[model samples]
Target: MKRLIPLFALCIGLPAAAQTPQLILESLVAKAGPASAARGEQLYRAKSKAGKTADSCAACHTDNPKAVGQHVKTFKAIDPLAPVAQKDRFTDPAKVEKWFKRNCQEVLDRPCTPQEKADFTAYMISVK
Candidate 1:
């Protein structure tokens, strides 16, 4: 149990073991074309009003991606998504996809496309 707990801690903070966020974003851009921060911001702030937990990404993430957020239902503190605010926010591709999967379903009631992911990430980097 002791060994498992320590392993879990390292797994939780495995950002250094993952690809840099820029590389993943570039891959996304290659598939999705040039990303637009404006479009990303629009998507980010748009309310779906379909999910039970929240209306849009902004409902929990805040209008400003650089600001810390709270989970709509759990009230758990979420670290800022902006790269500038939190250096390791999107460094892990697996973690990024995991959250995108969960959050998109919760807010958009569907899976996000490569374009949306690219734009959203670009917007995160653009924040200052």
Candidate 2:
């Protein structure tokens, strides 16, 4: 029982964002069984249905996870998506979900499934 107190305190002491990646991944795994980094890589590079007007993740992010990206239309600079390259990349659940929703719609013309999110997250996490 004494150990539980410290564990609880540790959980409570961390910011919500600090636990965002693990919590999001856990929930995704619960729904999807497991994420596939390979599938994620494929999805990330797949062209969107929007065709000429659409932008795949790689269109902006480039093929290398460690390299910086650039927005296709806006030409705005984007930070690397890899957690290793950017420590804060997946630290905010809200931000992560927000981008997922927006990007999925923009690229896939639909919302991504929990599996897709998990796969993508797994791929990003796998990057060194």
Candidate 3:
């Protein structure tokens, strides 16, 4: 019970963006299993099997997610993925879905599953 205090406090201290991630993660977990930050990190960094020239999310997003990213094809600047770096990230459900749909299609050649979305979001929010 004593150990739970700090955990609760940490949860309460999280910003509103964290809540959106939690809500998204929760909904995804209902379809998938539990979300995993480790899996999320793996998914973020993993090279795609889809054979795209920009094989991994990291190829565009950079290995350090807190840093700004640029598109491989478009070369357009992008905001950071980590909530700590860009507080607005994952806050808008429509924006989140839109990016996931576009990005997952690019990386995986298919839409991401709930598990992948949850894991990826978990990983992003976990970044300091």
Candidate 4:
């Protein structure tokens, strides 16, 4: 009974298991699914606070993937959804969290829900 008591106490004190990154990604992808690209497009075009309306994504970027942006300073023009470059970015969890937090507030007036983030990411991956 001594071992049983300790085991019970340990179980009670332990926190629930955290979700794996792959599982989280899978869940997010499920929300985004086949519609992810469309959702991404919507997010891209989401209005900023200035009330100018329209996504900043297309503002600096031209039709060509290589087209550059003037507003971002010297950074290369980013095609976030393009499949060719999809693997280059957004894979980092820290970067993902930062961008979503910043971008969602810029457009949606608040941080995105987990579902929204998941769906957005799903869409992002699909664009490539």
TM-score of each: 0.83, 0.81, 0.80, 0.51
Per-residue lDDT of candidate 1, residues 8-126 (tens digit): 53568753466656766775676688888888888899989777789999999888888999988899998988889989887787788899999899888899999999898888877
Candidate number of the best lDDT: 1
lDDT of 3 by residue, 7-104 (tens): 45347764223345556555556567888999999999989789375798999889999999999989999898898898878776667879889888
Between candidates 2 and 3, the one scoring higher on lDDT is: 3
Best by TM-score: 1
- When sorted by TM-score, best at the front, the candidate numbers are 1, 2, 3, 4
State the lDDT of candidate 2 residue by residue for 1-110, as single tens digits: 63243345346764343544556566566667688999999999987767344568898889998899998888899999888998888877668889999888888778
- Residue pairs in clash, model 2: none
Higher-TM-score candidate of 1 and 2? 1
Ranking the candidates on lDDT from highest down gives 1, 3, 2, 4
Residue 10, model 2: lDDT of 47
lDDT of 4 by residue, 13-128 (tens): 53123323333355445444433556656655555654233245455443332333343544554554343454445444555667777756655567777766765555555553
Candidate lDDT values, in order: 0.81, 0.78, 0.79, 0.50
Off by over 4 Å in 3: 1-19, 51-53
Worst 10 residues of 4 by lDDT: 14-23
